[model samples]
Target: MDLQQLPGYLTMALPLLAYAAFLVVMHVGQRRLGALAALKVPLHLAALGLLLRVGAANLPTPWPARLLPYSEALIIFAGVVLIIRAVDAIGVGYLLARLQKRHVPHILRQGAILLADFIAALIVLRQYLNLDVTSLVATSAVVSFVVGLASQDLLGSVLAGLVIGVERPIAHGNWVNVNGMEGRVVDVTWRRTRIETRDGDFILLPNNVVMKDTVTNYTLPSPLHRVRVEVGAHYRHPPNQVKAAMIAAARQCPEVLAEPAPSVFLESFGDSSINYRLNAWTMDYGRQEAIRDEVNCLIWYQFQREGIEIPFPIRTLVAPPPEPSAHEQRQDQIERIVPLLLDSEVFQGVSAPDLLAVADRMNLLTFGAGEMLFNEGDHGDSLYLLAQGRAQVIKRTPEGGQALLATLEEGQCLGEMALLLGLPRTASVRLERDSRVVEIKADLFRELIRAHPSFLDHLSRLVDQRQRANQELAQALAQQKTADAAGGIGQILRKIKSALGL
Candidate 1:
């Protein structure tokens, strides 16, 4: 090669050599850190800048040459790109989150990168291209004023976005209400903040408006939220009965918390009805609407079952009063209780006369949903035969939480072993819905057992079978097993025998 062309060859060859070295470094870096691949655009720009600058200086290129002046621009552009990439690679947002223990705004992190790029571009143009920095900066000042005047609202929005990023009031993915517009914050950009509404629609609110508006962030401080459901019933029903029904409905919802318990408030007497407000606490706010819907539906069902009237706005011209006769009421009670007793296996040998006698000694009890019949450690003096609705058997766990064992519907019975053997209640029974039950006290039960000699064996076997089942359920639920008194079933039978004086 000729000596004159040697410098040009060397310049071109040197850039190729630099480019090859960069490729090797990138390959290793990408293998170790996959995120490094995001720098591909800036890395290629830097390689082009090296090639252009080297060729312009060493090839004896003239200033009048078209490509000579463009080389300076290429170098400055490359430097700016590198500055931005470096800022992004450093992960300013992640660093801020770790240090401050809060989320940093994406706009602030990008702003920092942009500021660095501007500074780096200015330095490269001044030092490498010999550009007059002071005059160029003065010219930019005049251009900026013209641009700002043309885009007044645009500048305001940008400034508002910057202020919001610095204030950090609402983070992304939070449920918020602004001027009654409720949605989750999806993203905050330079000109606007995007919100995703509950109906799955996107709303872009200008940053300036978002800054000026009143924002209520439901997800802040804690995710636990209380849902309020409003209900109204006719004045014919007692307020206490209505409140009981509403509270019971809330308890039946699985999402509702039992610790805080549900509460019902009588708001006011409306034109045709009494208004009520029910409150239930839950942790799942994302499903807040569905949870509230379930509670309202449950309240409707409960009101219908309890004979509570939800009045309309129309006034009644004439209301009729009807009285139920004594005979009819007695017959209704007999029908409700008799079918339940006859359906049970334990009451198979209990004849019509014996059953009627037992029923006469029993009390017809009504429990609102979620009311506990008896706790695990309580002295059990009665057995309950459910006549209507359902109940759940729950054993208290070691962690102070209740674990449900079984659900008992109409015709099923509870507290039998406790009533017969004079033992502590095995598990608590809570009403799952408004229910009617015939409760037979221990003395009444014992008297009946004494009249029927064959019943003793059947009752003993039933107690033994139930205890084993209860133990197995406790084991599966990981609750502490209820220990028998010293000798297991033998001991329990002796206690029963002594209680009945058999």
Candidate 2:
């Protein structure tokens, strides 16, 4: 018991430090060589730590002459067990995963694993030190009771966490609207869970708060999603026709799945509008917003083609403004033409006079959200210049379903890809908000190109830049795919580190 009587504490601490250094080296070596290659590294470190401690005890010193052997042996054995138990915990993770069918959930499994490790550590401490856990337990109970009174909220939260882990009402990767926090679930930690909101804000909600609040999970067992596109056509338009057109709009949008297909529900009958809801299914939360844009855009075009007027959201107030002067009218036409010319990536090198002349021939049209500019595989000779609204280019899987791949915002132009390549429509596109656009019909577009030889070179350069950007995106996606295929987060991180020269 008189450990102080030992010749030097230096004798004990120095060797222990060497063993610690060795453990670090072992860990680093294992990680570098391969993450899974060092399964026994921790156990090896544990053994080395115990051996060093045992050797230090046996040094020529007046350390606890009677208890030295017993204490050293017991401590070393306990160290070994502690390390083994840590390995056991890893095994425990795999066993539970199999038993739970990966459905028992991660948060609960982590808690159970931590509790088990705590019990194992406690047992080693109690048996080796001849400590009376029962006596300690009694004292702790008294102290805990007093502490509990003062920490009711803390205890409540802890209990709430336990309840949440058991119930698992919310899960990882769920697109949940929690307490007005709308986003994807990034992680569920022990004390708190985090959500990455749609606007890219991270929210940490305590388990207790989460347990008590309202929550919605869009993707639980699977990632299938439904998008709601509210549409209002002219009241004069037959409600059933409007509904049929809306459904047709969504179905034509290659991104909208057909099995769930696109359904229309009569939501309301408004003063100036009869609302038809177009509900379409998607497989991804990230792409839902864009998909809705594509679907709504199609509906608008469909309605217009059918002579169904899409109403403007006006208060029906104020008298009409006086007619514009000829000068003002000409200026307005030029204003429309300037944007249409600028949006022509094909006209960048064209002479200013030629550009203006070509612009004069382009028709400027306004678009509202839920308006379809084009559908996948649609034949089109004209190109579009997105003057002001947001649009989404919808990509369909080879399996014959739609997915929104990209969002095209203001100043972004499309259909040029098809025009330049002379191929079928690569993807469908739609507007996201009420906005305006300019269209150059197919013949007019080619007429400008023939009139302006400078235009072709500009288009080629623009095409090259776009393709380069696409190449970079493709490379990034490939890297991500490789990482995902490698394994979990730790492995993914390692792969990124290796690939990126980190």
- Best-fitting candidate, scored by lDDT: 1
TM-score of each: 0.52, 0.50
Supply the global lDDT for candidate 2. Answer: 0.69
Scored against the true structure, residue 232 in model 1 reaches a CA lDDT of 86
For residue 407, model 1's alpha carbon misses the true position, in angstroms, by 33
In the range 20-51, model 1's lDDT, one tens digit per residue, is 89889989999999887767656776677666
lDDT of 2 by residue, 74-152 (tens): 5555555555555545555456555555556566655665665556555755766667878877898899999999988
Every candidate's lDDT: 0.79, 0.69
Clashes of each: 0, 9
After superposition, candidate 1 runs with Cα above 4 Å error: 1-69, 72-80, 91-95, 98-102, 258-260, 283-285, 304-502
Candidate 2 stretches greater than 4 Å from native: 1-60, 63-92, 99-102, 221-225, 266-274, 283-286, 301-308, 315-502
Minimum summed lDDT over a 10-residue window in model 1 is located at: 473-482
